[model samples]
Target: MRKIYITLMLVVGFSAVGIAQEINWLTLEEAVKLQKKNPKKIMMDMYTNWCGPCKMLDKNTFQNKDVADYVNKYFYAVKFNAEGNDVVNFNGKTYTNPNYNPAKANNRNSGHELARYFSVRSYPTIIYLAEDGSLLAPVIGYQTPQQLELYLKLFKNNDHAAFKTQQDFQAYAQAFKPEFKN
Candidate 1:
């Protein structure tokens, strides 16, 4: 009985060591507030409902355990819909799509002006921002968990500030240490 009890305790403890929940994705407003307190970088998954790559990113990339753990620890993860209904308060004013046309057959809405402000031309443009809501860079494409991890660390470490051009950043990204190698 003593041996069984000890074995059970060890199993439970080991299980607890690597268990983690889903990504604690935040709203833009909440992200800003958390940033002020924690001073970490921001990773925004700018998405739309009709986007295929956006869904893929959510299902495969954001759902991965390593990705979730790293993002939750080092960045304020934000899921911002390009055509969302929530009013965004930024730069001293609120922004929303006042001219959204619901009658159109396409999935277009009068997208949130903030999306336009950031010049997001694609559905799943991942925007990395500073703690103060300033734009760092917008990565436009579908990134697997491993691919996203490199960019996350690069921006988190402020390596982007070292680059003089996109070519320089591309060189750094090519040499980044990915999380899945372990």
Candidate 2:
């Protein structure tokens, strides 16, 4: 009976550990506040409900254990609905989707003012921000785990500061060796 109980405990503990290995997502406000307490870059997934590629990104890349673990360790992850009615306050200004129609919420709707602020014209745009909440860059499209790993590592290590021209970024992309499996 003692041996059986010990085995059961070990199984439960390992299962819990597996289940706990997920991205710790925070609200925009929460992420900004946490940045003040402990400095870390912020990664915001600006997506709409009707976007198929956005859904694929959530399922295929964001759900990957290696991607989630790396993102959680280096950045404060935020999932923002670009067309939703969430009011966001950043950089001493408030942003809202004043023209957001509830009936068209799931379909194409006017995006939030903050989305316009970042000039996100497409879905599945991953916006990277500085530790102080300033915009860094917006990577548009559905990026696989291997593809995003490059950008994650670049920003985390502050390698983006060295880019003087578009050619520089292209060279970095060409030389990047992806460490994550798709």
Among these predicted structures, which one has the highest lDDT?
A: 2
Model 2: runs farther than 4 Å from truth? 1-21
Among residues 3 or more apart in sequence or in different chains, the pairs in candidate 1 whose N, CA or C atoms overlap within 3 Å are none
TM-score of 1: 0.83
Pick by TM-score: which candidate is best? Answer: 2
| Candidate 2 lDDT score at position 65 | 85
Instruction: List, in order, the clash count of every candidate structure.
Output: 0, 0
Q: How would you encode candidate 2's per-residue C-alpha lDDT over 1-182 as one tens digit per residue?
A: 99999999999998886643478988899999999999999999999999999999988899888899899999999999999999988888999999999999789999899999999999999999999888999999999999999999999999999999999999999999998866
For model 1, state the Cα shift of residue 27 in Å: 1.2
lDDT of 1 by residue, 1-182 (tens): 99999999988996887444478988888888887788888888888877899989888788778888888889888898887666788778788877766563247666778789889989799999997889999999999888888888888888888899979978987887786422
C-alpha RMSD values across all candidates: 5.2, 3.6
Candidate 2, residue 26: Cα displacement in angstroms equals 1.1
- Score each candidate by Cα lDDT: 0.83, 0.93
- lDDT at 92 for candidate 1? 82
Task: State every prediction's TM-score relative to the real structure.
Answer: 0.83, 0.88
